[model samples]
Target: MNPEKALVWFRRDLRDHDHAALSAALSNAGQVYCAFVFDTDILDALPSRQDRRVHFIRESLAELDTALRARGGGLIVRLGRAGEVIPGLARELGVASVYANRDYEPAAKTRDIAVAESLRAQGIAFHTRKDQAIFDGDEVLTQAGKPFSVFTPYKNAWLKRLTATDTAEWQCQGAFAPGPAEGIPPLEQIGFMPTDLDTIGIQPGMSGARALWDAFRAGRLARYAALRDYPAIKGVSYLSVHLRFGTISIRELARAALADESHAWLNELIWRDFYFMILDHFPRVVGHAFKPEYDAIRWAERPDWLAAWQQGRTGYPLVDAAMRQLNYSGWMHNRLRMVVASFLTKDLGLDWRLGERYFADQLNDFDLSANNGGWQWASSSGCDAQPYFRIFNPITQSEKFDPDGKFIRRYVPELAAVPNKYIHAPWLMGRLEQEAIGVVIGRDYPGPIVDHTQAREETLARYAVVKKTG
Candidate 1:
């Protein structure tokens, strides 16, 4: 039975192709109208008006509108509260139903509920489908019928449960049902300004996602396992921003990886699902420790140290370099993310929330679940987290991952002229050596904020409240 009209609402799932809600709406309705909400409920909460994610979404939506126009429909974009706007749009279009992809964030869930209720009040049907993750929430659970807190068992079960149906593309066949030709507003119209996203080497929209995937597939996929750890090399796919924004579908990415011999990249995608599941099942982890006891461990209140870390002024080379990269570009190497996260939580003895908040503001690909999961993992306060005793040594990490200090040099140019031996710890250079290199430890670059050895011992004692053993 085909509905006379339907409205397909675009949220995080921005792309036109392989879109579950769009396909469902187009197939079931005689006329399907598409819409996207800028959602002031979300935008007003953002700390900055020059947010890169905002710019990225704007660019992606422009392309999406173009794509939808080719199918005899156009994207209806509005800047307002989604709860109010979605139902209003449905009423305006006189649609029988509203179709959308599911969002799992706590606030998003609440917003969706409100929207659903509003639509119901108007006697309109509202439908949502899983498009972001291959298996979200409890789809992959343990033998005991519980959500797996640990990743390995979850991954194993996830693989076993996978069938062709799970990865099959929701092909949007047939012409899109025609609707009003509303277009996206400019960034300035939405109270957002242009950012340095392009200058920092990021491309927004589905075409950009495809371009990055194609490049990654051409050569880097074969060496991803080996090179991904080294920040000096282009080992990682750089598709994370696209994934977060849903410019590309998860099914397409997973299916592409399945065709290849390597499964390392696929594991990363599974981690994304795992984090999402964790967030859905354990929403308390958003503000509290996942493991209750970890909360007992007191975090240091060092505003000065926090400032240094945020500004990339920390004395440790690798930590500073990673933080600098994040400050300069809206992204950082994944390996450096772990290193800096550990350094912030352990070495600095500061609250992980501080670093998490900073990353939330800085990362181009920030997702609340993934960001929270990563910070908790580094702090040993999350499920399947690093052991309380397993603090990362920033110096060793720098030497191992960036042997020639190329990554550090690129971000921390003050240490560019320092010798390879002293690059990771420029303070170790002798007075004569410093003079020879024309780089003074305290003058050219600030010294380490805190001694690593002393900080390590202090951190061990501090974390002993949670666990005695490293």
Candidate 2:
């Protein structure tokens, strides 16, 4: 007997091409339908209405609907809880099964389970495919049959295990006529406001990801190794937001990396997979430290310090500039993310969770695993984290990566008049020099909020609780 119909539920994977569940549904079922849930269970929890991520997702969904229409199918969009919505949609469409790409985040996984159980009760088979990561949690285990804590070994094993078949793209083409043609809801209809995404020159959808990939391939791929660390340069691929939303396929990216010999960039992709594995194997890392002993170390109750960091008035040029960039564009350079995270946890003596939660709210491309892993890595509280003593000196980092202060000047324009020599540390400028520049250190731009030298010593003392474990 031939399969009657199937539903492809879009989650993080938003595009039409190279989709696992969509391809499977098309191959198995006589008719296939596509749908997306606004998922108020998640959306209502957002702290702001002007969220860039929400705007990006909405735009991408519109594009997806258009793309599907061209293929004789269209998206079915609903705004409700997925557990209730998916089953209802499946029943309405009379689908034999519901297929979807897997989402690995703790909350997403729980939701998927609930949806699966609901579909099972209705006698509708619910199937999930591996589309997000090249390797799943169990794909790259160690010699001792345990998940890896360190990245280097995991990456080595991942590379050794990789084959051409693993990187091959899943071709999802042809017309799927049975799909519904409902139009996407506007931002206002969904209770979200327009954000600065467009003003910041961010393009949404698959076309945007393709354009970015083409630009990166033509201009930056060759010199990515040399230029990626410098924030002032357009060195890194700007496809991060696209990757987060699955506007582009991970397999396509990995394939392009291999074809272009972009080893450094490929390593970064592997790092992403590593973090996913960590999140899957150690779920508690979401709220607590990976190394439990590190949790014993005390964090300061300094709301003023956190507020200064958040508002970009910490008085350190690099850290302040990074925060300002995040505040303005909803994105930050990776190198600067680490520097600013270090300043927050080590210099300001605040908990890493504070920085993590702040980033969760601010970043347009925020992935729970990557954001949490980055914060714990910066705070020296996660597996394979930098040593506690190896704190980042914000001033030196500024002078080195952004020696000409080009990045600093762009984000923290108050320091534009200061000479290159004093741009990284304007507080060092003599009163006459500050006056000559038509900017006063304390009046125009605030002085250093906390002395780095003093903070470094205090951070070391505070981390003494984990000294034996070190």
Candidate 3:
């Protein structure tokens, strides 16, 4: 092979196995170097000190380091803006090219472009491969070369476009595994403090991801579609964070789902591609809706209500339990997501943006497109959205999803003593019964923050502004 080396810039795709860019870099070059940059631009904007993402990433990176070291290569860890750090490393290492997976986020794209430009100045070629999403922006566009806004058509088009070629795994054995080039920086020098992520009990690395996937395949895959709604049930794959960062390959997961009898679990993964394709075609949907006119809808901003919702004092048993779970665990079941989002925008009459921001802050698996799609879907402002006329009745949603109150009891303990029949709306119970339950409405727990019936009417009136533009 040639004597030149290639530097693999590892971003969200943090794994060694089936890593396209890493495998590519190692195969074509005489020597290979792997690196990761903790972008200060992003970290500076984050508000929390004990962010689960930061901690999760730390553990994942450590695992990646161990795996790479076993192959006679190690990770070059750095703390700074990626645009500055990546190219600097490329030049310092005298690498012929820098390879990485593409990030669809606008900020990340801009950062990568700048890094590519900087590397080009020194005659270094920067190559970005698609690793995060199975189908990227333009790859699945319409026949006329137009992007899709509606999901059903988009999904149909996506399924039609997918080939066996698209799902094939890139083997990372042989020449790629020969060994990594020497000279990686120490982790401690990067200004990021060592985090005790193991204590949080979150499984880390590709091995952890496979272990979880194996268990899900054995037990959870069959009932995923039905049980995924209930928060108390371990219905989800819990692989969002892994998928978010490229700790595991999307192709690997998708291939297994496609082969398995469980179409339900696979459909969930398809929904992810659906949202990513949504983001790719319409980048404007990042801050605004797929339909801009929906922004014209007047919101009934009630700060007190927003605070109550955030604090999980909504008084609607289902919505409160969902919100409380998000605050505590940084994860929420898909059913609760729709219910609480509808409660916030439709019942609380607040802007969906506020709820989106909260989820962005709290959710470990928070993907921009999915989060935006979900919020807009609940608010009836995006493609394939719920009609503005329809609003989720919180109590009914609870009774339906958690009919026996299994989920409700886990998160809302104040309602533990309430009968299953009245668990959805405990405030409706008589004072004597409330006293007997030992949890007072508006005292032991919060009373309903806003009357669902009244608020639904208010939301209808509030969204009337959209009609003029439409």
Candidate 4:
């Protein structure tokens, strides 16, 4: 006899603990089949064959399969378009229904719709749950029953309505009893080559996420507010990578933050939801601006500047260091992400979309909504975005954030010999002083790409077309 089958289709949310679809599948059917599809719709557009994210995803899935197999279950991995494959797999397994967590991207939403329709045509029910974010579509709203264009009001309402009921942990493996089996495709079989991070031991699974979460709760949660700006302090929760893969549950993290006294950490989580909510309401922001009038402003394509930015040769210590980190590691510190994004748009006078695409390409934690929202915010084109005139001063930013020049020194080793006073702006130091440090601007270190003074003037003029100020 065929087991009373249900298939849980894993997308972003990868963990067995606090997984809604996995739990629902366990309860609704006698036996559950778990699967993940490396959707080609997303993968085909990626320029990098050596994508660290693809490797990260495969590693996470490998761990997921092991955990599932330990509990009389297994994860079946497939590489194809999910819309084409999920329904086919469902029919093959003879499942009554398919369950999955909701994804908010416009393309993803369209793909899921197609998948759902395909399953429905075959008499297989497709069920989806809001797993990645705290507030799903229409869950948090104003008194006016309109989607929020601003964040603070939305965040307040989101907090006001919150209870233990709002952030409940999902319990997997309640009562399902099925035969344990090893599952999932081999790493190379999935067409993703291994990443350097795999060897560096960045910790890529459920256990790693739990370890980070536990450590964050015990030691770093209190200092998060003060030290998150300083990348050298190790104050920020390294959970962005985990959160990107859904190796950890958003509800569990939210619950922990909510229970804790610090509102700072909760604010970061709120930013995640805020971006997710923005994406759901305004999918137009993905390729364009949330505020459309900014579209009128002509942005320079400036591929040369873009190439320099990507290569970390921007000739600004802070900006160059941040880019080097991103180029080398698939991660960029959140604070530096904001700083570099602002520099690209408001300093170099380059298009925000270029920087957005760069972040999308390089960031391991790159979620479309968050990355888009961030770039647009820096460019003053997002909903409730910053004003155009408020450009980041890279030198001041470096001096303030990396006060002792620790972050810059780590990535810009050429500037290692420079005195503390001149580290942030080596070009400002005298040639004799530079010689003493065995450093020469335009030789050992490149000169500033665009003088901040000239760049600031150019940025202001460029944004004059889109300025909203009265």
Residue 118 shift from truth in candidate 4, angstroms? 0.8
What does candidate 3's lDDT look like per residue over 256-360, in tens digits? 878875777767777888787777667788778778888887787689999989988888888888888888778788888999999999998888999999899
Global lDDT scores for all candidate models: 0.90, 0.92, 0.82, 0.86
Q: Which stretches of candidate 2 lie over 4 Å from their true place?
A: 1-3
lDDT of 2 at 407: 93
lDDT winner, 2 or 3: 2
**Clashing residue pairs for model 1:** 315-448
Candidate 2 C-alpha RMSD relative to the actual structure? 1.1
lDDT of 1: 0.90
TM-scores of the candidates in the order shown = 0.98, 0.98, 0.95, 0.96
Full-model lDDT, candidate 3: 0.82
Worst 10 residues of 2 by lDDT: 173-182
Candidate 4: global Cα-lDDT?
Answer: 0.86
Model 4, position 169, has a per-residue lDDT of: 80
How many Å off is the CA of 430 in candidate 1? 0.5
Give model 2's TM-score versus the native structure. Answer: 0.98
Candidate 1 per-residue lDDT over residues 141-161, each given as its tens digit: 888999889999999999999
